[model samples]
Target: EKSIILLPRQNLEICSRRSSRPLPDPRPASLPPSSRPVERRRPPSSPPHLRSIRPSTRPRPPPRKSRRRKNSATFRRSPFSVPRYRPFRACPRTTSRRCTRNGDSREKSSEIFTPSCVIDFVFRWGAFVLTSRLAPSPPVPRQGMPGLGRGAKGTVYVVTDPSEMLKVLHNEGTHPTGAIQYQWPTKRWLKDVRSHLGGGDAPGEDHGFWGDGPKWKRMRTFLQTDLLTPRIAKGYLPGMIRAAEYASKGAPAYAEPGRFHIFSSRASFDMFSSVMFGEFSRMANPGPETSERDRMFCDHALDAAEYLFPMMSNPRELFWSAVGVRTEMYDSFSNGWKNAREIAMEKSYAFMDRASEDRLEGDFQRRSYLANALRRQAEGDAVTREELAEMGFLILSASLDTTSALVNWLVLHLALSPSTQRTLRKELTAAMRDRGAETLVPEMYQQVRTLPYLHAVLRESHRCTPAIPINVIKKNKASALEIHGETIPQNSSILLDSYSVGWDPEFVPQPERFRPERWMDDAVEGRKGTLRQVLDHKMYQKPFSQGARQCPASRVANFEVLTMISQLVLDWDIALSEESEKSVRSFQDVPYYQGTTVQPVMPGFSFTARS
Candidate 1:
C-alpha cells in the first residue's frame, strides 16, 4: 500500500510503499523560501515514472524586503555610472607617479602605472616639443625670436639684416661650396637613363655645373675667359636685340590676350639658341614638323628640371635608389636627361661641323659661344668633344628657363604699375632722342644701358622677384669661419635666404611697394651723395649669386632681360587684364612665394601698340 505525507510549513508530499525505502530530499537548504520546492497533486493520467517528479504547483511566496535603501531614483541608476566629484589635485612634483585620495593608497594603481606606458608618454610628448622647436617659422616671427632656426636637413641661419649678410658673404673663404648637392642624383639618374636608352656610355666625371675641385676650376676659367667676359657678353647684344624683335613680331599671333609664358619661352629659346649654337632655331616661327619636335624637346627639358629639383632637395627620395628600388621620379628624370642628351648631341655635332669647315678657311670663328669654344679647341685647348656637349647642355638648361622667368616677372610688374611704366617709357624716349634715332637701332639698344632709371627699374625688379629665392648653398671648404661672432662648423651647409634679405624692412623700407627710385643716386651739394642703394655687391643684390662660384652667364642674362624689357615697354602699352588684376589683389596683402622661386600667381597681361 502507498501513503501520502505532508510536512508542516513545507507544503511537500511524498508517496512510498510500506516496504520501499524513502528517497532523500533533492532540494538544498541554501535556496530562498520563495524558490524552495513545494508539493503538488499528480494527475491520474500522468506516467508513473513522471508522477513523482511533477513540478511544484504551490503559489509563490511574497517577495522579501529589498536589502537596498528605498530611493527610487538611486536604485535604478547604473552601477558603473560616473559620480559628480571635484577635479583631481594638481600633480605634486614629489609624488606625480602616484594618485592618492584622503592619503589612502588605492588598489590596481600599480597596473595603471607601468614603465612602458611612462616611456610611451614621454616619447610622444618629447616629439611634439622637438617638432615645435625645429619647424620653420614665418618670415617675420611673432615672438621676435633670433634669426637662427633649425631645419630637418641642417641649421638655417637667416640673416635678414643687410649688414650681417654682407659680412657673411664677404668673408666666404676661397673654395667656397654651396649647399646644393644635386649633382650626385642628377649624374646617377642621367647615367641610368642614358644606359637604358642606349645613348652612349655614362659620363666619365662631373664637370661644368656638376663638378668641383680642379676640374671645376679649369671649366670656370675657360668660361670666364671665352664666353662670360663682359666683352663677349657685349658682342651677343646684337643677337639678343634681333631675337627680341623676332619675338615681339610673333608675340601678337602666338600669345593669347592674357597668357605670355609661352611667348617668353620662345623668345628666350631663340636668343639662347642663336648665342649658344651660332644657329637660329626660329622657334617662334618654326615649320609644322619642327614645331612638334621643338615642343617635345622643351617638354622633356622642363619635366626633368621640375622633377630633379625637388628630388635633389629631399634625400629620402634618392634613398630608395640606394636600396636598388627604382621610382617614378627617377624614371621621369631619366627620360628627361635622355631627351636632353639627344638635343645636346645634335647641337654639338652641328657646331663641330661648322668649326671644321671654318678651320679650313684659315679664319677663326668667334662670333657665337659655340664658335668661341671651337676656336679654343682648334688652338689645342684641353676641352674635349664630351665636355663641349656637357657644357652645351648646361648652358641651354640654365639660359632658357631663367631668362624666361625674369621676363615674365618684369612684364607683369610693369603692366600693373602704370606710373612706373610712364617713367620707364620716358627714359627710353629720352635715350632715343639723345641718339637722334626714331627707330631702335642696335646702337640704341646698347645706349639704353646708360639710362639711370631703366637700370634702376631692373635692379628693383630683381630685388622684388628673385628667380632663385634662396641663393645656392655655400660651404666652408678649409675650416670653420666666423661671421657676426658665430662660428659656422667646417663642411657645414650654408644657405643665404635671399628672399628675407630682399624683403627686410631695415634695408628696403616700404619693401612691399615697388619703388625703383631707391636704387638711384641723388645729386647733393654738386656731388653725388652716398647712394641710397646697397653699393657693395656683397652688401645686397646677389640675384645671380656671388663669390668664386658665381654664375658665369650673369652678364649675358642681364643683357637679355634688359633688352627685352626695353623693347617691350618702348613699343607697347601693357597692363594686367581684368582677370589677372583680380588675382593679384587677392595675394597683394601677403608676399608671394612659389616653387623654388618668388613669383606672383597670376601670369597674364594685355598689350596694345603704342601710337
Candidate 2:
C-alpha cells in the first residue's frame, strides 16, 4: 500500500501512486479537510516515519486562471516577470526619432547593435585583406563584360589586352578620364578643407585632375609649361645630380639592415624639394637635425595606404559618416591628406609672397615651377592661389610616394641581380667619360639618356612592376562601347591593366623573367621579341600610360629615376639583405596595391660602397 502526506501549511501533497497515467489538472493535489477522502491510519509494519502518515484516495483540483490584469503595471510589480513592451525612445547618438512596428511604438533602430551589421562590416574588410594576402591577383572578381569588375566608385573594366587598352586610353573624346577612387579620401579631405577656407562652392570650377572637357585642357596646359617641356626639365638636372650625390652617401653600410624604400623615399624627397621648391625646401640646409615639417609629411603621407582600401571596400564608411560617427580609419585618412595639404598650401603661400616681393633666389628657384606659374599669372594668366596650391600638393604627393616607390622597385630589381648593377655602372662610366666628365655631371645627361643598357634596365623594371598598375578611365559617351565584340555600357569605368598586360605571355615572351636585354634594340634573343621591335610593330609599354590623359610629368620622372640609378650604381653596390630575401623570393611574392599604387612590401637591403 502507498503512503500519502498532505501538509496544509506548505500547501503541498506528497504521495506515491501505481497509475501510469499523468494528472490532467495543473493545480496541486492538496485538498480541504472536509473535501479530502477518509484517511486510513498507517499500519504498524511500516517504518516510524511512515507510521505518522495516512493513505487517502482523492483527485487533484482544477487549474485556476490569473486574477490580476496582464499589463505593464502588473509586470513591474512582479519580481520574476520581464516587461513585454518597451517605450518608444530616440536613437542613441542620433536625432530625435522613434521606430514603430505593426502600429506599436518601439526603441529606435540606432540604439540596438545587431549581429548582422557587425558581421557584414567585418566580413567585407576581412575577406578583402585575406584574399589580398593569399591570392596572386587582385581581390576583385572578374566577371560580366570581357574584363568587368567593381570598385568603391563605379563598375570596373579591366582591359588586359594591349590593343584594347590602347583603344580605351586613346579615345579620350569618347571616354573622358577620371582619377581613381583610390584617391577618394584625399579628394574628400580637400572638399572639407575648401569649405573651412571659405572657398565657397564653385560648381563648374572642378580641378583638372577630376574635371573633363575644357577645364581639363586648361589645367593640363598650365602644368605643361613647367613640367612637360624638355628645356625646363633639363634646367633642373644640375640640382638633381647634386641631390643624387647626397643620396648616394646616405646609403646604408654593408651588413646593415635598412629599408630600400626609406633610402629611396628620403632621396626622392630631397631631389624633388630642391628642384620643385628651391629655397623653400627643407633639405636646402641639410644637417643632422630633422625638420618637424619633414617628419609630419613622411609619417602621414603613406598612412592612407592602410585606410583607403578598407574605406573603399566597406560600405559602413558611408553609414558612419551619415550618422556623424568618426571612426579611427576615417580620421586617419582625413589627417593624412589634411597634413599634406597644410604643408603644400604653406609652401605655396610662401612662394606667392616671395614672387610678389621679387625675393626668389638661385637659378633653380627662379626657374622653379611655382615661379614660372607666378610669372605666367602676372602676364594675364587667370590662375588663382587655390589652383596653384592644388598643383603644389600634387607635386608634393608624387614626390613623397609614387616616384619614391618606383625608385624602390627599380633598386630592388637591381639589388637582386649583381650583374645588372655592374652593367649599369659600366654604362654610367662610359657615358660620363664620353663627355670627358670624370664624375657624374649635368653635361653627360644626353649621353646617359641614350645608353641602351640603362634604357633596357628602366624598361625591364617598369615592365616587371609598374609604379601605377591600373590606369582608370571612364566611358563618358552616351552610347555604349563595343570592344572585342562585347558591349560595355555607357559610363562604365575602365582600368588599363598594366600589370596583367606587362606579364601577358602572348605580348611578352618569357614575361616572368626579369631580362633587361629583352628591351635592347640589338637583342639577339629573337629580334621580334625585343621591346623596341614590339613598340615599332605593335603595342606601347605604357608605363606612364598613353593618349591625351597620360602623366604630364613622365619626362621629369624618367630623368629623376635615371639620375638616381646612375649615381647609386657608381657609388654603392646594392644587394638584398638575408632577412628580406627569406620573405621575398621573387617579384610575385611581393604584396600588391599599397595605397592604390603597385608599391610592394620591400623590407631592407645592404649597400656596400664600390672601390
Candidate 3:
C-alpha cells in the first residue's frame, strides 16, 4: 500500500509499503476518464532478497517551496498581481462603457483597457473591420428629419439641405475638400500615371486637384491670379476658336446615325489641345498628311477617357479597388492610362526637342501653352519634364471628359429647344454686328461673356444638370459640425449634393421646368431686350464649387463652351435624330444625375451646314 502526501509548494511525495495493496489515484475524479491516472499492480511472486526488505515508514523532511527574488522582473500569476495599466481611453465619438475580464468587473481604481480606442485608430487610418465589430455608438441627434445620411465608405455625412450646404461650403476650415484621389482605382491609376510621367510619388501640390493644405493654397492663388482668370482665358480664345473650326471638319462623321460621341467630345479635345500642346493639336485635326503615330496617340488618349468614365460613375469600383480585386473594367482603365502616358511622353519629348532648338515660332506656334512654359523651364524656371507631363495629362483629361460632357449637354439642350436656340442666335448675331464681326472672334469675348441671355442659358442648363453631382468635403477631426440643429461627428465627409440641391423646391421654384427666364432680369417675365434689367437671381449655382477648392479652370471651361456653342450655332443647324430625341425625352422623365459628371447617353444627331 502507498500513501500520497502533498508537500510544500504543491509538490507530491509517495511513501510505499512492501504489500500487494495499491494506493488510490491521486488525480481528482472530476477529471475525464481519459485524463485520469492509470493504476498499476506489483508482481505476485517477488525474489527472496526483495521480499525480505521492508518499506521505510519514517517521516521525511518537507518539500521546499520555490521562491522568486524580491527584485525579479519575471511575472507571477496571482489574484493580487494585476497587470499595470497604461492609459487607454475610448474614442470621443463613443461613450464610456464598463469593461470586465473573465466575468469579473474591473476595479474602479485600476485603468481598464478599451479596445475601442485602438479599433477607432485602425478604422480612421487603415479602414479595418475590427471597428465594425464593435457595438455601435448612439445615433447622432438630427433636427426635424433632415436629409442627412451616411456614405458607403465611412463617417461620410451626406448633406442635402441648401442652407446647411452653403454653410458647409463657406466654412472651408470645418469642411475642407479632399479624398478624391484616395478612392480605390482612381488613386492607383493616378499613381501609375504620375510614375510614368516621372512625377514624384504624389502629384505636385499646386498642379493636382486632389491635394489640400498650404501647397494647394499657393498653387490655387497662382492659377487664379496668373493663368485661369477671365483675362487669361480670353487671350486663349483665338486659339480655341480656331480649334473649334478645325474640329468642325469632322462634324459629318459624328452627325452619322447611331454615332455615340456626337461631335462635342472631339471638338473639346481639339480646343484644349491647341491651347495646351501646339504639336499635339494636329492629332485632333487629322488630314491626308496626318501620320499613323498621331492617329495612334489620339486613339490612346480617347481610350483613356473612355476607361476613366466608369471609375468615376460606378461606386462598386471603389470597393473592388480596396480589396485589390482585378475586374475587366479595372484592367481597361489601367492599360488605357499606361498606353496614353507612354505615347504622350513620346510626343512630349519630341515637342521639347523642338523647343530646345528654338525652332518653334509663328502666331500658331506661340498659341501653345506648353511653349511658354518650356521657355520658362529653359530660363531656369523650376519646371521638370514630369511636371510638364502632369500638366498635359491634367489639361487633356479635363478637356476630354468634363469639358466634353458639358458641351454635349449644352448642344443637346439647344437642339431640343429651337426657341431657346433662335433667341440665343439672335443675341449672338446682334453682338457680332455691334462689333462688326462677321464671325465670332476672340476680341468679342468680353461682350459675349456679359450677354445676359447667354449667361442665363448656361446657368439654366447647369441648374437642370450639374456637371459634378456630389462634391466631397471632410469635417475637421478636432471639431464637430452643428447644422440644422443636428450634430455631425468630426472626421465625417460632407458630400455636397449639388444635384439634389439643384432640384430642391425651396431653392428653385418649378425645379422640374427648364426656365432660363428665372436667371434673367427681364423676360416679359421672359422677354428681356438688349437694354435689360437685372433680376434678383439668388439661386445657389456653384457648378465649379466655391472658395479655394473650386475648379481652377472654371473661367477657361466657360469661355470654351460658349465659343464652341456660338460657332456651332452660326455655322451649323444642329438637329437631334429621332433616336436622340427619344433619349432626351426619357432623360427628362428621370432627372437623376449619372456618373462622376452628367454623361448623356444619347442615340445620335444630324448636323446640317447652314447656308
TM-score of each: 0.67, 0.68, 0.65
The lDDT values for all models are 0.50, 0.53, 0.49
TM-score result, candidate 3: 0.65
Kindly provide the TM-score of model 2 when superposed on the true structure, using C-alpha atoms: 0.68
Compute the lDDT of residue 9 as modeled in candidate 3: 13
Q: Which digits, one per residue and each the tens of the lDDT, describe model 2 over residues 1-611?
A: 00000000100022222111221221113322222122222212321112233333456456466553432110111111211111111111221112211233333222211111111212232220101101113212222221123444233444444555555654547325655323444445556666222221255555434456455556667776777778888877887887788767767632233345555667777777766766423332246664677756655665654455445544455566546577766887787777867776787888789878988887778887778888887787565777777777666666656667678778878887889998888878987787788778876665434587987887787677666544434453455665555666656666444343344444455555678887676553455654424332223353555555556776677778888888888988888777666655555444332343445445467777788
| Most lDDT-accurate candidate | 2
| Count: clashes, candidate 3 | 4
Segments in model 3 whose C-alpha atoms lie over 4 Å from true places: 1-153, 160-163, 169-176, 192-210, 213-226, 257-262, 279-285, 289-295, 307-320, 323-325, 375-382, 447-449, 471-474, 504-510, 523-539, 578-596
| Clashing residue pairs found in predicted model 1 | 177-475, 178-473, 179-473
Candidate 2 overall lDDT versus native: 0.53
The C-alpha stretches of model 2 lying farther than 4 A from their native spots are 1-154, 180-182, 195-209, 213-216, 253-258, 279-290, 318-325, 443-449, 476-479, 505-509, 524-542, 579-585, 589-593
**lDDT per residue as tens, model 3, 256-371:** 43233435666776777666665435434467755676455545665554444335323355456657687666776678667766766676677778777877767666656667
lDDT of 1 by residue, 198-278 (tens): 122235444333446455666666666655676667888777777676667655553343236556666777777667765
lDDT of 3: 0.49
For model 2, state the Cα shift of residue 96 in Å.
Answer: 57
